[model samples]
Target chain A: MWDYSETVKEHFYNPKNAGAVAEANAVGDVGSISCGDALRLTLKVDADTEIILDAGFQTFGCGSAIASSSALTEMVKGKTLDQALEISNQDIADFLDGLPPEKMHCSVMGREALQAAVADYRGEEWVDDHEEGALVCKCFAIDDVMIRDTIKANNLTTVEEVTNYTKAGGGCSSCHEGIENILAEELAARGETFTPGAVGKKEGFVNLAEKEAAPAKLTGVKRILKIQEILEGLRPALQADGGDVELMDVEGKNIYVKLVGACSGCQMAAMTLGGVQQKMIEELGEFVKVIPESERPVEIAGA
Target chain B: MADIYLDNNATTMCDPEVVAAVQPYFSEQFGNPSSLHNFGNKVGFAIKKARKSIQTILGAEHDSEIIFTSCGSESDSTAILSALKAQPERKEIITTVVEHPAVLTLCEFLETEGYTVHYLKVDNKGRLDLDEYASLLTDQVAVVSVMWANNETGTIFPVEQMAEMADAKGVMFHTDAVQAVGKIPMNLADSKIHMLSLSGHKLHAPKGVGVLYLRRGVRFRPLLRGGHQERGRRAGTENTIGIVGLGKACDLALEHMEYENTEVAKLRDRLQEGILAAVPHSFVTGDPDNRLPNTCNIAFEYIEGEAILLLMNKQGIAASSGSACTSGSLEPSHVMKAMGIPYTAAHGTVRFSLSRYTTPEEIERVIEAVPPIVEQLRKLSPYWGDGGPIENPEEAFAPVYA
Candidate 1:
C-alpha cells in the first residue's frame, strides 16, 4: 500500500470542490481513464480582474490523484489567472503534505489542467507541445516531448524518475529503451552524462536489468554469444554501407572481426573499423577492443 | 467500522486450528528433522504425517509423490526445469498468457535461454482455446505448463484435457494449481498431469510451505542438490512447523470443501449481484459458469480501480485491483488484458475473493460499502456524467495529451 499522508486522505475523503463549476467561464481536462488517471478542472473567473473566483475538479485516478486535484482546486481559488499559472505540481503536492514518488504524475496532471484552464480563459490557441514529438510509449500514449520536458524540469537523471513525473515508460515498458533514449538526449542537452548501467534501476515487473547491465564482466562463450547478438542487429546496417563484418574470433577482451564484401579492402576500412568497434564497446562492454582479423596472430588456428 | 477482507486470493487468514496444531512444534518440539535423535525422529514423523495428509487431499496414489518445497514458485520452477532436463532435445514450452508470475516470469526467462515459449492467449471471457492448444502439442514441445485457474479473474482452465493431450504426445504437463487446490476438488491420481504445484498459504495454511506432486514413474530431476531431503528432489531441512500446519489446514479444507462450494460461493454471488445491480457500467469479468466458487472479479467503468480500493480501504473493506496503479506494474492485470477488457474497464477491475470463513453479514457489509465507493469515485471521474458513463468510453477514457 502507498504511504499516503493524512492530508491526502483527508482531501480525498472530503474534497473541498468535488463538482463542476456550472457558471465557469473556462475549463481544462487533462489525462484520461485509459492512462489510469484523469482530471477535469472547471474554474469560475472574473473576466476583468482575471482572478479565479472558484475552482472545482473531477478526477479519475488513485487516492493521490484525487487529493492532488482537490488540493489544486483549493490552491487556485481567489488567485489571479497569472498567479494560478505559477502554482507548480510541487506546490499542489506540498498542500497535500506530499505524494509518493510514483504518484508524482498525479500532481503533474493537476498542473497540466491548470495550464490548460488558464489558456482557455485567455482565449489563446492551446497547442500541445507533446503532439510535435514522436510517440514513445504506446501503452500510455506518452510522447517524447512530454518525457523530455519532465526530465528537464525535474533534472531527472533516471528513466524511473521520468516515469514518476510523466507516467511514461511505466506500462509494459517496451518503451523503456525509448524512455532511456529520451532521457539520455535531455540529460546530454543539460550537459549531464547518463550512466548506462543505472538505466536498469527499475526492476521486478520487467527484467530489463540484465539487458542494461554492463557486458564487460562477460567472459569466454558468454561474451562471444553477447557479441554475436549485438552483431546480428548491426549486420544489416553494415551491409547497407556496402560492408559486412563477421566474428572471426574472441580472445580475452579483444574481439577480432573480418570485414567482408566491399568493406574488406575499402579505403574507409579504418573508419568503419573504428565506428563498428566503438559501437561494439558501447553495447557489449567498455573493456572490449575490436581489431581486424588480419592484425591478430592466429591463436589456436580455427579459434 | 468492522473490517471485511475479501482479498483471500492474495492471501488468506490462517485457520486457528492449524495455528494451534503448529504452535507446539515451534518451541517444545523444535528439532532438526535430520538429526539422529528421538526429538528429531518425532519431527520427521510430523513431516511425514503432513506429507500424507497433503497426498490424501490431492488424491495421490503414493505419499512419496508429494515433495515439499519452500513456496509455490520453487515448486513451479522445479517442475518446469525438470521437464526441460528430462527432454533436452525439445526446445519448445507451451503455457497460457495469464499464468501467475511464478510460471510466467520463468517462461519469459526461458525465452532468453534459447527456448521457444508459446503463450496461449485467452478469449475475452478468459477461457483458453482448447483447439489452439491441441494444435500446439508437437514433438518439439518439451513441457506444457498451464495454471488450473487464473488468479485475477478466477477463470478455470481445462488443464485436465490439456494434460491428457500433452501426455499422449510424450510431452510432460505441469499445472500451477496454487489458486485451485483448496477451493476446488482434486484427484490427481486420475489425471495424466505429471506435476502439480500448490502453495500452503492459499488453503488457510501458513506461508513458506508448498507441495509439488510429481507422479510416480515420471522422469524427474532435482532443482536443488544437497542433503538427501525431500527424497533428494528439493534440498534443505523441512519446514517442520509450517508443514504440520499445512497438513492440519488441508484436513480442515477437506472437511469444509462442501461448505466452500455451497455457502462461500453463495456469498461470492451475492457480492457480484449487489454491485452489478447497484453500480452502473459495472460487469463481472471471466466466465460466470466456470470459475472458482469464492471469487468475483468486477469492473466498474469510468473510474480507476486504485481510487475505488483506497476509498473502500477507508471504510475498512479489503479487496484487490487489476489496475496498473494498484500493482505499480504500469499495465493492468495480464488476465484482464488477455481477456480483451478495454482500458476503461480493465483499469477499474477489482477482485473480491472469499473463503469458507466468509460470513453472510460480512458479504452484506461489503455489498453496502461498494456502491457508495463507486459512486464517490464516479463523481470524481471525468468520463462519468450525470446520466452515467460517457458515450464512446474507449476514446473518452483514453489519455488526452497536452
Candidate 2:
C-alpha cells in the first residue's frame, strides 16, 4: 500500500461537500466511463455579480481521485471563477499529502473539471462544437480540436506533458510529432513566430542523465524486416478477441507489437504475448524475440 | 472503521511475546554489542542467548553456523554474491526465474557483467522443471539460488532435489527461505544445501533481523568488511532488539509448526475455496497442494490488484497482489509472467499470506467482503456490458445490482 495519510483517508471517506448544487451556474463533469478515472465536478458560481459561490464533485477513482476531488472542492468552495480556474493539477496533488507519481493524472482530472466548470460559467463551449473526424485516441476520447486547444492554451512544452495532461499521447505516441506540428501551427496562427531550432535549443545542451538514458534509445531503435509475413501469422490470435497486433518495428532480432483498440488494454495480453505472439515468433526460430508494448496509448496533448 | 489487513507478505505486526522479549534490549540492555565493557558484554550475552535460542529451534548443530544479517534479502545477497566472488573462475550461475529479486537482480547484474545466468523456467503452476534445471547444470556453474517457496505464488519447488543436484554438480547452492523457514520445518543437517537465508518479519519477528546458514566448509567470502562481528562474516553492530525478537519468534514458530501445518492450512484453503466459489472468473495462482500452508493467491479479472487491495484495506482485510498497478511499474508480475499466467489473471492476482495469528473469523469477513468488491468492479467492466458477448455463463450471472 502507498502511504495515504489518515487525514486524507478521512477526507475521502467523509468528504466535506459531495453533492451537486441545484441547477448550478457552472457544472463541470470531467471523467467518463471510457476513462479509467473520471470526475463529475459541478460548480455553483455567482451569475449576476460574477462572484464566488460553491463547488462539489463526484469522482470515480482510487483514493487519489476522491482526495483530489475533496481537496479541489475545499479549494474553490467560495473562490471567484478566475481564482478557482487557477487551481492546477499540481496544486491539488500537493494538497492531498501527495499522490503516487503515476496517479498524478487523477489530479489532472480535477483540474480539467475546474477548467470545464470555469468555461461553463463564462458561457463557453469547446471550440470545435461539432466536427467530422476519426477517433484520434479512442481510449481517451480525445479529438483534433481538444488536442489543438490544449496546445494553444497550455503552450504545450513537450510531447510527454501532452500525454500526462490530455491522455492523448499515451495511446499511439505516433501522433506525437503530428501534435507538435499542430502546436507549432497554432502558435504561428497566433502570430508567435515558430523557430524550428527552438525545440532543441531551449533544452539546448545534453545533460549527463540524457547520456545515461541512452540505453533505452539504443534498445528501442528498430531494424528493418519483412513486416507482412510477421503479421500474416500473428493475425489469427489477434482476431480471437476482436483485437489485432501490428508489428511496429523489427530491430534485428526483437519485434515490437502494438495492441490496437480493445486489445490494447485487455487483461489477456500475456496470452497475447506468450500464447499467441511468442508461440508464433518462436515458431519462426529461437533467435526471434518479441517485445510487445501491450498498454493502450490514448491521445493525450500535453500542455 | 475496522480495516482488514492481509498483506502479511509485505511485513507483519510483531508478535506480542516476541515484542516482550525485544523490549528489554532497547532499554535495560541498550549498551552496544561492540562496546568493550561489562555492560557491552551483557548485550553480547543477550545476542549469544538469542543465537542459542534460534539454534535450538532450527536444530542447528553448531552456534557458529547461524550468521545474523540485517534482513533475509541481505542474507540472500551475501550468500549468492559471496559464492560468486569466492569461485571467481566459475562464470555461470543457475537459478529459477522465481527467486526473489535480492538474488535475481544480483544474478542479472552478474549476467550483464560477463557472467552467464541460466534462469530455469517454471510450469504454469509455478513448479520448476527439474529436468530443465538438471540440463542447465555444468561443472563451471558457480552457484545456484532457488527459493524454498515463492513469495508470490506460494509454489514449493523441490529444493531438496534441486539442492542435491547443485551439490552433485559441485556448485554452491543457496535457498532464500525467507518466507519458508519458520512456516516449514527445515533441518539443515538433512539437506545437502550449502547456504540458506531466513527472514524474521515473515514469522512475526522484528523486521531488521535475519539468518544466513552456511554449511560447514562451504567456500565463501564476506559481503561486509569491518570490525569483527558475526564471526567476521557480516560486519556491523548487531540489531540486538530485532535478533532477540527473531530468536523468540523462531522458538514460537518451532512450537507451532505442526498446528500451523494443519489448522492454518485449513484456514488458507477455506479462504481460497470461498473466493473461487463466490467470485466469478477467479482462480488460485499456485499449485493447490504441495505449497506453503500460509499463502493463497487469487486473481479477480477485469480489476486492478491495487484497487482490490485498497478496498480490502478499507474492510480491514489485508492481502497483496502481483498486479503491476500496485507499483510504478504498470506491467504485472514477472513471476506470474514466467509461469505463463495470463495478463487478465495477472492484473487481478492478490496474495493472502496467513500467519499463526490469522484467524478463521478474518477469513470469514474476507469471504463476505471480497466477492462484493469484485462484483462492483466487474459490473462497471465494459466487457460485461450489453454490447459484449457473454462467452462465459458467469459473466451473465449478475450479483443482483445494488
Which candidate ranks first by DockQ, i.e. highest?
1
Name the runs in model 1 displaced over 4 angstroms: A127-303, B393-399
DockQ-derived CAPRI band for the predicted complex in model 2 = incorrect
Measured by lDDT, the strongest candidate is 1
User: Which regions of candidate 2 fall more than 4 Å away from where they truly are?
Assistant: A3-99, A105-303, B34-37, B386-402
What value of lDDT does candidate 1 attain over all alpha carbons? 0.85
lDDT by residue for model 2 (B275-314), tens: 8898777888878787899888887765557667776777
Please give, for residues B1-402, the per-residue lDDT of candidate 1 as tens digits: 568889999999999999999998988889898888988989999999999899989999999999999999999999999999988999999999999999999998889689999999988899888889989999999899999988888899989999999999888999999999989999999999899999999999999999899999999999999989988988898899889999999999999999999999999998899879988789999998999999989999878898889888888889999998886555678888888998878999999999987889999888888898888888878788886877765565444572
lDDT of 2 by residue, A224-269 (tens): 3334465767687678768887777665555677778667767655
